[model samples]
Target: MRSQENGPIKIDGIDKMILNAFMENANIPVSQLAKDLGISNTAVHQRIKKLETSGVIDSTKVIVNPTVLGYSTMSFVGVFMNKPSSYKLVLNSLEEIPEVIEAHFTTGNYGIFLKILCRDNLHLMNVLNQKIQQIEGVTRTETIISLEQPIVRQIKL
Candidate 1:
């Protein structure tokens, strides 16, 4: 089931249907899923278990509303490292900042890109100045604040 080349996992039709249903609602009851799919509850449960064990289903978590939680500012930071050898150090430093929600090693102008969530502009500034800039290898950063997110959804199956 694991691929060294990061290839797609082998999934049949039923697995696709099951994945689509779960993606629509992760909290859906297994019995209801089974009924809707015209399959036994035990069969559905076994399939789900297999999917989880095989790393097909990584995790099921509640998606919290960041706005409701007072995280109003979403910003992306493009990190420029001093040298290639500094990547690991910069990544370790980035992880210590709680505001950093996501980080990716990219292929373009920036060595690393980060998605940060903050309560306000001031919070974002503090994170950039006091936290991110403190990392030795991080020579500079370019940030763009998100005004709105019109579309956000998982990929089609």
Candidate 2:
């Protein structure tokens, strides 16, 4: 079926429950999910397949601990760009960098803001000087280095 332009996909109660279960653990097996939801494994598998085909469920991935990898410095940089009009063109450009974790457009003095994860001062400096500043319209930036983050998990259904 053809989907409408710019509207959220309608999710029924059953689908919502299935999605919530999967969100908690993307690598969950169909049998376990079926057992937990009190449904047949076949039903769970079909629903997951449907969601994937419809573009609602993207690829599953493993979430890793950055601290365990010895990447301790976490910084949020709010960059003010001179060229404020090119958001879409610039957003993709920012995502190309490996260090940039999140880039958001907000209503503030800054045109673009990014959350960057770096190994140390040298890494962070390289990201700023070579990577970020190279982007057009990035006039000024204010970086807030996080000493410690209380939480960094997504809150879902």
Candidate 3:
């Protein structure tokens, strides 16, 4: 994808088609995608290369099911900081905790918001009290347990 005047990256219909196909199945063979798109394998390969080089396509990842691994609890925690300057330190410390799957420096009532996965409520409690709360810059936390994730998707191209 290339942009005009360094504006938003522009993608043609073909690029959108390729991206949509990959979004459905990342492991789709280039030849199959080429056949579906009515393009040569070389063209498909070149387009994918261009997309990757332009940073339009990030890395392909294997989606892991946390429940299968005994991680049944998913919680969102809003972390309150003792001071604004302590953010980096708190963030660095949070990175050490494996249960913290995602963290965001956000606006509003929280300094940092985190997505945590654990085996159960007790495991979550342990993480919150013994791990997150123990961090020097961390003052308090508010957690919301996710009972079900009804919708999870990427933005439509």
* Among all candidates shown, the one with the greatest lDDT: 3
lDDT (Cα, tens digit) per residue for candidate 2, span 1-157:
2243656666677778888877887777888888988999889888888888777777778888997998889999998877768677677779899999998898878888899999997899999999888887677678899998887665464
Candidate 1 lDDT over residue span 12-125, tens digit each: 788888999999989889999999899999999998988898888999999999999999999999999999899999999899899999999999999999999999999999
Name the regions of candidate 1 deviating beyond 4 angstroms: 1-7
User: Positional deviation of 107 in candidate 3, in angstroms?
Assistant: 0.4
Clashes of each: 0, 0, 0
lDDT tens readout by residue for model 3, 1-157: 5743587778899999999989989999999999999999999999999888787888889999989989999999999998999999999999999999999999999999999999999999999999999999999999999999999888879
- Order candidates by lDDT, high to low: 3, 1, 2
Q: What is the lDDT of residue 2 in candidate 2?
A: 27
Residue 54, model 2: Cα distance from true site in angstroms: 2.9
TM-score of 1: 0.94
Q: TM-score of predicted model 2?
A: 0.82
Q: Name every residue pair that clashes in candidate 1.
A: none
61 Cα displacement, candidate 2 (Å): 0.9
The C-alpha local distance difference test score for the whole of candidate 3 amounts to: 0.95
